[model samples]
Target: MTERESPFIDRTGKSLERPQDQWPPYVIPKEAIDLEIERLADLPAPNNGRRESFIAHPRAKEPGLGLAPGIRVSLSVLKPGERTKSFRHTATEVNFCIQGGGYTEVGGKRIDFKQYDVWNHPSYHVYSHVNDTDELQVRLCYSDAALLEMMGIYIADEDPPSVKEEERDYADEKNRTDPRAKNPFGTFQLTDDGAWLMPYETLINPETVESKAHHWPWEQVKEHLDKLSALGKDYVGRRLYLLYNPMTGRTNGTTPNFFATMTCRPEGIVDRPHRHTSAAMNYYFSGRGQSTVEGEIVEWKAGDLMLSAPGWAIHNHAAKEGTVYELTIQDQPLNIAMESLLWQEDLKLPAAILGSEAGFGTNR
Candidate 1:
């Protein structure tokens, strides 16, 4: 075999203790984003009718260029009366409309969304965006495309078929009659310690849970969020609500890979320093704030986007004035699913693997 084909490294006795390369916190000011939106708006419309830009971190590499290690954020804009071509991808997404209003057609369903609305796109579902109104539409889309790209499985189809054929019910006729579908030797316990042996027939046919798109309008969410301010100064927990999708189950995410939370930080409210294995990015829309990330203070105002917390980096935020409304996207669900979500709710306490252990609680 050629030397290029035999790509193997001998590490029989090499030292395993190597420092982790954690990315530093970064921020994209409102001005930079506004300029980019203007620039995109000025450009001639592309053939696909989609004008988008990826927000890459300074330390990010080609395989997974994203603002966070596993979370990819992209800015998309559409002119009035314009619409994107039909497209589908393996990576699920959380779409947030930051400016104007539009509607998205996904999986034969139409979702009409306004400014500050949040919605999820299910995996492998063909979708397209339309701006039927007179105003320009701007959106921030967060996805696991970066992670999928790193894994060499980020498949996207720009020319998906305009009409998807009706799905056949496998369990209705053929599966019920097929002898191979029924396993004579079913799964059974093999050990007292909970070990079990599953037949190949059973292994290939796992339970299916239908995943659907859900929308949370900002006005509806805001009404509920504003009530949390009454929790007063004595409340210890953050005032936020996870835009949960039931399909994620115990993972607590908007998509399988990420959780999007809308936070309401009352004036002068400060959070206690905490750390987690999942990286976090925040988009502040309504007020100014400062985040102390890894001992470095980073100030931000309304319309700014920030990489508030790198994985496992201690961080905290304080509202400077008025009620601060921000949308935080974190790769917590992926970590939790992997049983690697180490969360430290308090600096003085020990960190615990969140999904696998007893998690921390706050005084209500």
Candidate 2:
């Protein structure tokens, strides 16, 4: 009987054997891995520290679902001579030209954006988009009530107000004219001296944020983590860049609010039981591992999102050879505003820190 048909005596006479090496064949330096972690930790948030802006055409496609909460991704299509109304808004927004071309008019200035180009708009900016493309498409990423509420900056206008030209004038007067502005998002005044809002810094621009090495620079990635580490309050592990931070005008770098990080566990690696004060979510990027979230052993994989509420629990991570998901938070804003932040880095140390091992495992 063929191996497939034979229950015993070797279907096809094949035998399976476990390889001596469980991890991937690739070699990875601990220092290099630590540097990568630092890079992610040092990523900078948006600010007048850099000039950031974009002009998306009217005809754009919808941006797909993202990991952030309370955000909606969508696309728009604009035809020639089709102009959008100019309005003042306070919600953060980003857009990328997917297939078409278009121009946006802000403060009576026209900026053009084409496919693969990204644009960032800060909160409380007066702007509008128009489609002047013969055949262009656009996609945009933006947040709704969910994001606003998280930052404690939500505003509700239950009633629509009549058009006011004077209000438009005030917005137009605040328009930025400096070509050297460094922020990718539109600039906003924090003080009379000119403090630019940088809510888009963490979302690095391919054309901007120079990095000479193979990996992203430390400041370009790890600044977010550093910010969280600085906050000495109920801080726990985290996942980052889920959304834009209004205060810094950046993606997921350092926020005056929340933070996160993904952990990596090579095959056969196990992070012994440990606990912390901050609640967190683990977004598995790859590999196979089991995390004892609270008490239950949770098997994980790529794209899987796990949660860990605040306080200590018997949590451990194990994998034959793969990367583990990681996310932690101390609720920066909640602690800062309430003046109740605290942290203990050395406390409840896990036996194996993520990225401690050097090697790879199964490709998956």
Candidate 3:
């Protein structure tokens, strides 16, 4: 018989004061992305019909290679008249169209998107991308797959089967009427301090909220964002709108793991220096800008993607010319749900544990 080694490590009297090593801000220039897209377009279609490449940070390690610690960004290209095989994964995703137009079939719904459009994919929902146009279609897909991969539980199925509509309806009805699905004793308060005792049935059969795919067309969002410039130069808050998904509830996200916001910055406008525990990545689609991250200056222009804010790193952005349009994605919802979202809207003020504490507000 083989003997197993002990899994315990003795840390007696050892100091537990290890400081976190934050990753440095990185940028993928527009030229590089364009070159890659062209290269992808020239390659023969794979068996799966998915031509994709991950944008990884230099500091990232294997098993979870991502531009940020918790966020994975991938550049995917589909040639004209091409489509990908059906796929489903346990990780949720935010999909942003960068070039051309295409449609996605996800969870039995078809969402047609154009350039600069934003959409989300719910976890475990079978999806496929199709490029029915005459031009090559490109997208930037952001996901929490890095975090899941780090936890060693990232799951993906190729060509997954679709759930039959009648079977799904029948199963829902059965679960609704099953006696074992209900807890007779119910969850009751056990102490004055808010502790409660829950039965096994209740623990296993929690309320289910339908997670759906949502689309945010750029033309529609742009009209509303353009109005933010009317707020003038005195506005303290960011000129952005979050692409919200109702299923996330109080977490305020487009998906369970991340929040996607479209920001419109007028010429010469600068953002205040601030820091947050959640990392941020931005894709600029219009005009030019410069971001100061941890005292380092990084300039960007239209079609550039950057890791503007590494976790807890001080950062600020300024528009250089024209109206700058950018799409920013952050793993803020996951942090809030974990009670670890620390945000400092103003450098002069102390950081707040956002979600649990009152958040900072801006004047108009």
Candidate 4:
């Protein structure tokens, strides 16, 4: 094969061969992502009247990235004073606010939201994003659209009965055990003993049952916020807030398939590389920075979305002069619950990268 031929494609044989290295962990640099999204902002909405909906199709012509099975990450960019016409879909969606603030109407109800607010849209729930802010509004949204599409059940439209409402219920495994019960709110699951999560079926005391919500407002959970700096300089520090579920004391995500997190990389800090099975859909919330994924340097600025797909590469994060705030939605929580979350860190680096052997770890 020529040098320009794709590593993922096997032109030598009649059958296709997908080499792992060819699709090695990669990044959707913020620049290209923002460029596409900004371009979408200026265009007219489809007949559905969604002002601008941006989804990074994982299977692009170039070497694309998809962090996990059954997951699709997208961005919804709305200009000032714009609102989307009501539409519905069969895919469950979790949304993270990246820039500006707005309100959304879900199932005929109004939800006022702001930056860092994590929200959800249940399957078949009629919803619309209403951005009244003077500035452009950007959001990182993810869903199991790929899975639904594969099953031939995915539907998105403003029309009626593309799918039966009952079919939607069967598609949603919110309770996992109860197929008929509708999840009017957020859900939880237990993973480990004395961990943030516990299995739901094993609990003995009904009175002691804990529950987590579908949405977590940044202002409300500010006190529970933990910073990576709290670990001292000994740890390659980054500041992040976890959305926890009060129910199982485990991860608080909109759905069981995935969860979200917010991290703040201090100015000039370079975090070490780590490899894991969970894919992370990353958003550059603020400031400027870069991530080295599979030896590819992906530079990004504020409002950029980068996807670090699972099993692809070792990912290291770094920030420029200013602190970089980031939002990451990943399948880590689900892996932890299944007791199969495998990960490793490469902390030992050259003296030049670590500054000094003594500077590598804190004095703790």
Candidate 5:
């Protein structure tokens, strides 16, 4: 790097540029693993009323595999019959259920969650999780929690919510900008028993009633998953975009801070390189595969995770000729919202990438 690009500088007017290995836009194939659960189980509420953070603390240790300016991913697990302490939050926590089944209590509302379900805990809301089942429950959480804390705008209240569900003093639109309250997709409402109130919507006025929590049920998602895993299919992209909230009908399910989608690379297919500014953190649900991140092969299997460094990493995917299913989280919506999303595809690979060997493809 040149003088301006050097990271280290002193009064000598010279700088030391770190090695390229330190540079990001690379992959961290599952920086976190099941080991986190064992560690957390030894502790107590949501955090065991404690916390075991994977991300580094400024005063303590070196940084882990992560991105800059605010994107972060972490883990939280609760043993069966364990519950987290209730609190009003200041962090944006979006969770993808890694395993186990339970419900989360948010603002006096109940959200039933199961394996592979995606949900968000809104900022400035009262929330906690309850594991009622007989197995270990893990949550793959993504958020800008550390970012807000680092910026000095962080807000967290240990106090519980004083207002009951029936007594919440909310305006017609509690907070329009909050994705939870916005509810652009579905018409739902609050009931006395903490159940959702699903109302009908009219073309004239789409906003009728809505609920606080949103869930993408895996039961409903399984049909699509099965259809994508067909044998020798003539037409298939093997990728599913998890946008469009079924309730709200909005094209996206996530907030601007993050968006997640699922893709499947079936047996014997090799994908070409593609790049974008939005870094992708991929969680492997099932399959065996290897990714070439800028020529760095990152091999992964079921239950592992990987990252495609943001900003121009030539990444390609291939299974050991085996089936692979990937769940990816990226800040693509954020970049697009900020008008900074760029994408590129490698021109060298033939159309065989998507199993389109005939050189025939349909735009639709």
Candidate 6:
């Protein structure tokens, strides 16, 4: 095909077979490929101080590494005996330990960390990290840029204060020393020899967070909600509670992680259709509602689930006469990591529409 006359049209409206390497021929859009290529091309060549050519963000700055809207990712390296000063961020974080070992203090609790360990920091919480190992160390950080932007927050830090002599308290070490101290709050049930998570379970035990600074299992949380509803105290006008499970932020450090939250709206409530940075699945329980998923009017009843992936169009829900409930789970870490969240409001709710594409997740 000639450069101007071709059968295939790319996102940039260029001929597919052009020799200029505008895009990957069969994969991503030519415009997207051009964007990526342009990004890579903008990087300065490696030099003495910057040994790593692909060092995206060398500085630990706030809103540090912006890839796109609503996402921020940063990777850092620490040489032996080199460590970061105590710092805090307005962004919640999920971090993966790529190499070496170190010590981390979150909310005044010190935990020894090693390769493959994951760590999470709640939004705006002060935390510190140190590397005492003899080898180079690295970490991958993911944060929600959109949420932070909405809240008008950023990461800030001060130089590490000189150490002072104070008696360290090992009182919180009871769970570490005792074998019978497992799951004092029934957070992670002993499914086998080790603890396994159930989809609907919640971490009700306050000690779980106190000990590990992380919350897992949502079943117990659900039971807590059940009791509140039984007492007629619905979950409305309450702070949006979250079960933060960072994929690489867990102690065990696994990927493809899951995080979910329960949201309820009393009668005559409507949440406008919007898109987010990640693919999400909403499990509706114990309520009736009308959900418009990507232009399809989906009447959601109890036991129904709705799913929407990135760029899958708009989605929103409206409650019936009584309260409406739903649990939304998403790969938020990835979204926050990649920064591709989108939303729209100010327009009236679209008229009820219908389509044959209405369906729920298979696991629903």
Models, CA RMSD each: 2.4, 21.7, 2.7, 10.4, 11.5, 21.5
Error of 4 at 80 (Å): 4.4
Candidates ranked by TM-score, best first?
A: 1, 3, 5, 4, 6, 2
Candidate 5's TM-score: 0.69
Off by over 4 Å in 3: 1-6, 10-15, 165-183, 233-235
- Which regions of candidate 4 are displaced past 4 Å? 1-34, 57-69, 79-81, 155-157, 160-213, 218-238, 245-252, 336-340, 345-364
Write the residue-wise lDDT of candidate 2 on 1-364 in tens digits: 4457655664474557643321111112224333443443244532211111211112212231222233333334444545555554445444444446677654444567765344455443456666676763343333332345565666533222423433545543344343443455554667888765544432342233321101112233445644544664454333233333344323232233343332334456665454433334343445755666545656665544344333233355567545443433323333334333333333353322212222222222
Which prediction has the highest TM-score against the true structure?
Answer: 1
* TM-score of candidate 1 relative to the true fold: 0.94
lDDT of 1 by residue, 184-287 (tens): 87899999999999987668768888989999999999988877767676667778999999999999999999999999988888888898999999999998
In model 5, which range of ten residues has the least summed lDDT? Answer: 350-359
TM-score per candidate, in order?
0.94, 0.34, 0.93, 0.63, 0.69, 0.36
Tell me how far the alpha carbon of residue 328 in candidate 5 is from the true structure, in angstroms, after superposition.
Answer: 0.6
lDDT to native, each model: 0.91, 0.40, 0.92, 0.63, 0.63, 0.47
Per-residue accuracy of model 4 over 11-53 as CA lDDT, tens digit each: 6747565655524444566677668668878887555555444
Error at 237, model 6, angstroms: 35
Residue 37's lDDT within candidate 3 is: 98
Model 3 residue 217 CA deviation (Å) reads 0.2
Better of 3 and 5 by TM-score: 3
Residue range 1-364, candidate 6, lDDT tens digits = 4576787756796556743211110111224323443453344432311112111222224433332233344445555665455666556655545457777676676767676445566654556666688875565454564345545765444543333423345764664566565544544566677876643223432323322345332345556555655554443333233555443343112122234555555667776555433445444555776766556676655544344332234566678856665555455544333433332332353321111123121110
Count of clashing residue pairs in every prediction: 0, 81, 0, 10, 15, 9
TM-score of 3: 0.93
Q: Candidate 2: lDDT of 64?
A: 15
| Cα error, candidate 5, residue 335 (Å) | 0.5
lDDT (Cα, tens digit) per residue for candidate 3, span 214-326: 99999999988878768776666778999999999999999999999999888888878989999999999899989999899999999999999999999899999888999
* lDDT head-to-head 2 vs 5, winner: 5
